[model samples]
Target: MHALVGDAVRKACSELFSVELAEGQLQLQKTRKEFEGDITVVVFPLTKLSKLSPEATGEALGKFLTEQVAHVSKFNVVKGFLNLSMSAEFWKGFFAAALKQDDFGFASPNSAPHVMVEYSSPNTNKPLHLGHLRNNFLGYSVSEILKAVGHRVTKVQIINDRGIHICKSMVAWKNYGNGETPESSGLKGDKLVGKYYVEFDKAHKAQMKALIKQGMTEEQAAQQTAIMQEAQEMLRLWEARDEATIELWTKMNGWVYDGFASTYKSMGVDFDKLYYESNTYINGKEEVEKGLAAGAFFQKEDGSIWIDLTDEGLDQKALLRKDGTAMYITQDIGTAILRFRDFPDLAYQIYTVGNEQEYHFKVLFMILKKLGFEKADQCYHLSYGMVELPEGKMKSREGTVVDADDLMEEMATVAQEVSAEQGKLEGLPEAERNQLFHIIGTAALKYFLLRVDPKKNMLFDPKESIDFNGNTGPSVQYTYVRTQAIQRRYAEAHPGFNPKEANSEGHTLSTAESEVVAKMYEWPAVLRMAATTYNPADIAHYSYDLAKLYNAFYQDHQIVKETDEQARNFRLALTYKTGVVIREAMRLLGISMPDRM
Candidate 1:
């Protein structure tokens, strides 16, 4: 609806005023607090073209706009700015259309190319942490936004289920676990395995200290050699298909998978495919050999294979270690090859990783291009900055890392407490209360993480972020509930008045309600921008703005007690449509709306 008005204004300016406006020149921007209008237009850019004073230009343009733009019912000139007030009839049409459409703000069928998003690459040695939660939420929300914008989206996850760290866990388990299972330990697989990992680190450090006290050089002490030996023994057992060791590994990994599945379910994340390192690690070794044969890769005397990417502004990347085992980059290359073969027409491959690995992805993509993968240039590193606490960085070694499950439980507990304290759970059953906590908890976490730009490091201020008061998830959820409450009351009071009935009388535009409706109409543009930029935070910010506008409109305007029947019904219909749009927008950010605060 806003687009229609902008188009009409632009056409009038171009054809009637002899001014060639830019595509987005006549944007429906928000007015300042002291301003009388809801949407403001800056006519400063048109002053030169009009060859007149700024105020004169604004006045002339405003007059032309009101006369020519059918959707815009009124306009006011404020110095060099033009504020547009859209017609109520136009809003009624827009609201009715929005209500009739199943997909509120989705793009047309023929819009854009396919994009692949990869996220949540958790290591096998440990379960997910607070950092992984942010990555997962951003990736999932962006994928959903892209799909809504008519882009074919492939959501993928690469499991970092192999490495020395994984081997360390295996070593600890083999030597000290005594064939104990996760069921026997009564712990999640990742937690059970993570415990032994900490144990190994402690023992390994003690052994190193002992070796150093004996006056041996760090390398000569063979401290690392002992750890590697233990790891190698376990790897040998695993490769030989030792039934006892395999059984334990499989059981522990299964428990971890179960834990991860539950977390994903609560967080509302899903993937089209899951790529495992164990399956893809060997694929690139053959590709490396081919690259070596083609002279694209070089081998050292000790047999380590590498690609020199310095010519492409990247450091040399190790393709295979001297021991011929696949490294992290090796598996990623193989996965890319396999994915390309699986989906030949994939236009973009996005890797949602941390900013610390920026150099790694840069090198990885350069190597792929060097190896003659033409589509390698299309790969993108969606490097989100780290999530630090208010104090500083979260260091796992210092035990400051927040576990994903524990964080969710904490948020849920807080939600429950706030609900009870506010006495909002009066009529909600116990089961319903529990469900609301889950929804509110997930929303708080997701909204807190997604409200900031992905490229900048965000400080998770525990006290401020988890608060149910102003500018948080709970606030937005409360606004939604309040709107729903009003609608429910109105429906009960006027049993014969159907919300779905199309109004022939047309709406009468109020200054405040028009502003709210205009903001609501901009949802499609916001979704499109976020999708194109791969920034889910844009949607988060946009939803917050919409909720704020709705809250202001609800507080100052009486929707249920309007005197005019046509005006009352029209306003109720507007509120109903706004509620739907807001709910859909929140869902795209993986947020749930409660019917009551």
Candidate 2:
């Protein structure tokens, strides 16, 4: 409809005023709530073509559109704006057609350029945390949104498995672990490794304090600490492929992988591909060598490799240390290249990392461009803000961060308690009841995290997220269930009823119906906007608003008991369409909806 109106306005200008208006010169918006029309066209820009007063220009365009556009029934001019209303037949036709489209908001699958999204790059030294939850959900949701809009998306993650961080855990376990495995300790593999990582930190700190007491400076103490030295030596040995160090590294990383698989399964996120630093760092080194050969990078006196980017408004960045170890940016470079190689038709490479690495990505992308990769300009850093608990921020080395698995379990527990208090799903079989709880819990978590704009920091409160009344996911889920209940009752009372026989051709819609139908008309545009902006918050908030609109309509009207069969059937059809949209929107967010609350 918007496109149609835009074209009509453009034609009106060319015919009436003899002026050609470019694409963006025509400004159109959905009529404001205070307006008495469906679509509003701004006449201010077209005034240049008309050379008339704003009101006069608007009047001219409104008359031209009403006469020329087929679906445009009438129009009115206010100030410099021309508001156009559609005919009843137009809306009826739209609603009837939309009813048949099971995938209305999504485009048909296309052989478009592939886009790769990398996220949840976790280290093996620690378990997944709350920050990782947001990353995974955002990445997965963005990929889905892109796919829905006809982009071929590949979801991937790079495990930070080989680093000094992992070596810290290995060194700690070797020095103080009494040979206890995850099975013996009754802890998850990632958790066990995380425990040793924390132990290493505490031990290193204690050694630092002792050296400080012996009159060494803090920096001196940090470099000279016994535990720190051991960790460093362990990293060097692992790099050298020492038998004992490599064996320990392999075993510990394997344990962490098992733990990660379980957590990922529980969280309902998956990756199409997985890269590891251990595999890609060497590739990065090769790329760095190629850069040096091409004069894109220079070798320092100490054998370290650095890229001089001063001309590009950045300082020199080190690609490799003197000891020949790849830096984080180095691995990223190789990963980007490898992904492009894997998908030769790739269009975009998006890295979902926190905001702190914004500069690092800037340098990495610049270097890739300098290295003559055409797709380097397509590389983008989806930098998002950190997530903190209500009390404060989280620290992984201090073991103060909330574990992702634990937080998910806690969310389910809260869901159960809330459901029990509300007395929903009572007397159901245990398995079915538990499934509902999980669905509700997952909806709550994902919606809460995705509701806020990804660029801003958020404080996730489980209590606020699980509420049944507000703009939460469980509330949306309950609304869907309510719609199902209405349909069930309708089925029981009128078994032979067919919505096609309702006949809504000439019926005048009430205010509630108009509002809801208007909202439904906005879904395709909203989804397209979300895909363009790479923001799931757009979809999340739209779902909430749609649910609220349906609930408002539900509250004001009695569906099954209306005396007019046509009106009742139209209301029932509205409810059905709302349910379909809610289910589809929640699915894009990676949330499941239960049939009953």
- The numbered model that scores best in lDDT is 2
Clash counts for all predictions: 0, 0
Give the poorly placed runs of model 1, Cα more than 4 Å off: 1-33, 37-41, 72-79, 108-112, 217-225, 236-248, 463-465, 493-497, 502-507, 561-563
For all predicted structures, in order, the TM-scores are 0.91, 0.95
lDDT of 1 by residue, 1-597 (tens): 456656766776777568778765555676675766556778887777777887887777778877876766777888888887666677656766776676777986537787799999898888789999999999998888888899888999998876667768878777788977777888877788888788778777777778889788888665454776787677667646689767766766676788788878878899999998878877877778888999999999999998887777667778998977778889888988888888887887899999999988888888788789888888999999999997799877788888898899889999998888878787988898888998898888899899889999998865564877776777788778877888899879777766667463655676677667777777888988898788888887877888888887877777789877777877787778777877888888889898875
Which parts of model 2 are misplaced by more than 4 Å? 390-392, 397-400, 461-466, 493-507
RMSD of 1: 2.9
Taken over the whole model, the C-alpha lDDT of each candidate is 0.80, 0.88
Candidate 2 lDDT by residue in tens digits, 382-451:
9898887676688665456877898888778778989899887798998988878788887888998898
Which residue pairs clash within candidate 2? Answer: none
